[model samples]
Target: MMDCQRCGQRNVLEIDHVLPDGTEVKFFFCHTCEEKWWDRDGVQIDLTEVLDIVRRHRE
Candidate 1:
């Protein structure tokens, strides 16, 4: 469980996800602050980049 950066909550929910290109990532949600973020290879990633990656692989 990771801490929520916004609210400093100690129990952020984490979900593992795979992109359209089969890239693995982790999605985190903070219940307290209603914040969401994605991580790939321990690095933070933006939702727009994730969407672009999916769009590029759709063809």
Candidate 2:
């Protein structure tokens, strides 16, 4: 099973991109973490933008 790279949680429900242009590199994250960090963290950059950024990065 995969776990979150940040919190090390095993409830990962989505994949996260570490780079722009929809790269393949990513990490797993749970719904809670996605709302807290992914939505607010400066890492995401665009707030309104939503891409296959989640599914495309899945391992």
Best by lDDT: 1
Q: What is the C-alpha RMSD of each candidate to the true structure, in Å?
A: 0.8, 8.7
Could you tell me every candidate's TM-score relative to the true structure? Answer: 0.93, 0.30
lDDT (10s digit) by residue, model 2, range 1-59: 55555677767665455545444343335654653324324244343343455445553
Best TM-score goes to which candidate? Answer: 1
lDDT string, candidate 1, 19-49, tens digits: 9899999999998889999999999999998
After TM-score superposition, what is the CA distance of residue 4 in candidate 2 from its true location, in Å? 0.2
Kindly report which residue stretches of model 2 are placed more than 4 angstroms away from their true locations once superposed. Answer: 14-27, 35-59
Residue pairs whose backbone atoms clash in candidate 1: none
